[model samples]
Target: MPEFNEKAMHQFNQGLIKEFRENGGKAVSGPFVNAPLLLLTTTGAKSGKPFTTPLVYTKDGDRIVIIASKGGFPTNPAWFHNLKAHPTTTIELGKEKFQAKATITKDPERQRLFDAQAKVMPTFNDYQKATTRQIPVIVLERI
Candidate 1:
């Protein structure tokens, strides 16, 4: 497989973000097409600036569940750390955007939410197998 390119990934994410917004939360191109996608806007941990990331998500009750897999990277994604620093964030789903509180799951709930998402997108299972760290499962509840 090709090596990860941070600059390229950022550019691609920008494109995806544009497409998602243009289509009212639907990604018309790339791997996320037809997938459940959301835009998570978190405050940067160190910079204290807003950063928006497009992520795949699953619903748990009225909460939104997301995985910090980062394609099974050894460390958690930047957004995860951002959330740790600032739990209140913004979520853009479908055509609606709202404020939400981010919470990291624990124990059986974490495993269960991970399993539920893996059932929807098997890549999460592979992501878990590829990393040593326990990938974090986060829930976003409307605030």
Candidate 2:
């Protein structure tokens, strides 16, 4: 199979964002909605501006986790940086919306959690091979 096209992938992300906004962020189901996931917005750490990104996530105890795989890109995603600068963020699940604090998990702990999640969605392993950067998973705890 051909490698995923970055340009095309970005276009798709843009489209997903547009559709998500117009529809109040009700994720288009199928396998993605199998586990409870939601859209989240993180304020740009450096710019101090907000950005919304739809994410596939799952709950780990009381925390909601989102992976910054960026389809396995070499660099960390912008949202990761935003959360790093400011741990506070917002999330929308189904018709409910609320705020949360982001906690960027590091080694050992991160690896264990990532592995657990990858079991639920194996594509995550493929995502790692597609990029040079180690994907960072952010755990959002309701505040």
Candidate 3:
């Protein structure tokens, strides 16, 4: 596993968000190649601090969807933890931004949402096969 450097990761991700917003559709994280995504700005579940994570997304009407795969790691991503504590968040899509609510997909419904999203993000299937944990699909509705 890679060492976790909170500061470095924050700087790098913030740069990505700035670029994504400034460059319109021309700029995006490396993850965007296989899936449409947005930056989810959230508050920490424990520390109560703010953080942002780049997440693969799908659109359902006016809502944005994200999955907490952590590349199939055993643990959920920090962003997912944070969003659980603070379900309300911010979504940055290209040059736009909006308030949103982070809702974890539930039970049988999760299967459908997960399959639908996986169609757009085949890498998610790879993530699933890599770990035993259940990857969560977090749906963010515009608020």
Candidate 4:
């Protein structure tokens, strides 16, 4: 695998964020085009700063679910840690934005949600197989 470049990733994320906002939370082009996505804004765990990340999401009832796959990397994503420290967050879906509370799911529910998303995205299955740590499944409920 190629080495991870934090700066490059940040730049890419900045562009995606701009596109998502300008297009009403839709990615009209780029790798995430047409992919179900949402903007998750979480308070930084250590920085005490607000950080926004564009993530692919799935829905369960009235809640939104996101996986911290990090492309099956060894460690969880930073946003995951941020949510753990501060569960209250902001979610931008489609053309709407709202406050939400993040809940990390466990066991059967986690498995169920992960499987459901993998069926829709397929790549999640591969992401799971790539690492030993069980990926975290989080539910964001409107607040």
lDDT of 1 by residue, 1-143 (tens): 24667788789889999999999999998899999999999999999999999999999999999999989878788999999999999999999999999999998999999999999999999989988999999999999
In candidate 4, what are the lDDT values of residues 1-143, reduced to their tens digit? 46667688789889999999999889998999999989999999999899999999999999899999988888899999999999999999989999999999999999999999999999999989988999999999999
RMSD of each: 1.1, 3.0, 2.6, 0.9
Task: Give the RMSD in angstroms, all C-alphas superposed, for model 1.
Answer: 1.1
Per-candidate Cα lDDT values, in order, are: 0.95, 0.79, 0.77, 0.94
Q: Candidate 3 residues 1-143, lDDT tens each?
A: 46556688678677767766666733444644434557788998888887877666787767677788877777888898888889999888876888988889897877788888888778889888887989998788888
Give me the runs in candidate 2 sitting further than 4 Å from their true place.
1-11, 21-25, 29-36
What's the C-alpha lDDT at position 16 in model 2? 65
Ranking of candidates on lDDT, top first: 1, 4, 2, 3
Candidate 3 has what TM-score?
Answer: 0.84
Whole-model lDDT, model 4: 0.94
**Per-model TM values vs. the true structure:** 0.97, 0.81, 0.84, 0.96
Name model 3 segments beyond 4 Å from true.
1-12, 25-35
